[model samples]
Target: MGKTPAELSIPAASISTEIPDIPVSIPSQLLERRPDIAVAERQVAAANAQIGIAKAAYFPTVNLSATNGFQTGTLSNLFTTAARYWALGPAAFALPLFDAGARGAQMAASIDAFDASVAAYRQTVLTGFQEVEDQLAALRILEQETEIQNKAVALAQEALKLTSNQFQAGTIGYLEVMTAQVVALDNQKAAIALLGQRLDASVLLIKALGGGWQASEIPNRDKIGGKTKWSQFLPIPIR
Candidate 1:
């Protein structure tokens, strides 16, 4: 069947297949593939970068200024060398030897923020794995349940036919025919409900798998350790 645009967005690797005994994924492996976890990882990176920004305050600040203009009030003497004047070389430096431990406090706070992001990322992975497992179990149980319902419906249908034939031949009462009819309808209704449940489970299972996404696609710390440009981050949105 054709896929919707939203469905197409999931990575093909994350989709369900007909193969049996699909292996469960490692926790770290699932963390890499989930976009929510990738976003958390980026938050960690951003928090680490803030640490550098805080440390930068400890460096010296450079003050630079320059001025050049005609000194004479009269417009006539504005172009003359005698009236021309300029001032420069008043640059100064202010080193931040200390800030009453403010820098240290900022660094510590950044470290804590990074740690929190890492913890969030782990929780996201755990939650994602749990959802996948839950759906898998649901699908399995419902599959068997649907099969049983199918058998019940078929039996009910056959019994109803037999009852109808017997009633027409005056071997059974009208009440027996009505009872068989009700049983057949109830079993068929149950089968329909089971089919709907399986569809719901399939969709949930796909979502848990990150729509065919893989963790390897998320960038690691090593990729951002060097001189990186703003444009380099364009290809992948945090989510």
Candidate 2:
């Protein structure tokens, strides 16, 4: 969409407080959804067809024809007096008996092309798996970091509350309260940044999984306080 983010009607409250529950081991068949894998498979099919064409060159080609009609010698009695007859024979025949060497070379070349296509298809599948694994690993590691950072934020908030109370009672200077405020703010900022990283990882993992995956497959957050659905963050419907 060419529209700005504000035009998309995404609510800030849609942001997930906990990471979505994604499976660590993905099925190999999911890689088939990727466009590059589809293209590579198509190329392999074309190469196999070419091999068939090459093998056909070694076989003989035969052309046959047949005709049946009325035959009469008299022009006036052509329709009334006629004899029924039919003829069938080979009109043309060809067999490259002396060109076996050339045909063999063609067949070899076709086989080579097919092998190359198969290799390319395998490579494409491997690459797709690699990308998905990379994103999954990133999301897993980021989730751990986010959990630890949340604890840090909580501790900072507690510290700030204590410092503010001391300042109000004249037990501490105003400068100490300001320093506590800065530390609490910085921790909150770090927690927010971690959330952003986790969201980014989720998006990339979705992309790597391809469009065929359904939103239902993404497990919702029941362990967390909120029961936010995965579809809330995604703009488009999964196929």
Candidate 2 TM-score versus the reference: 0.71
| lDDT by residue for model 2 (7-69), tens | 788544434477666764566666666668778887998899899989999889898899877
Clashing pairs in 1: 10-211, 11-211, 11-212, 14-212, 32-215, 33-214, 33-215
Q: Count the backbone clashes (under 3 Å) in each candidate.
A: 7, 0
lDDT of 2 at 210: 72
Report the lDDT of model 2 for residue 208. 84
Candidate 2 segments exceeding 4 Å error: 1-18, 66-89, 212-239
Task: Please state every model's RMSD to the true fold in angstroms.
Answer: 11.7, 13.9
**Backbone collision tally, model 2:** 0
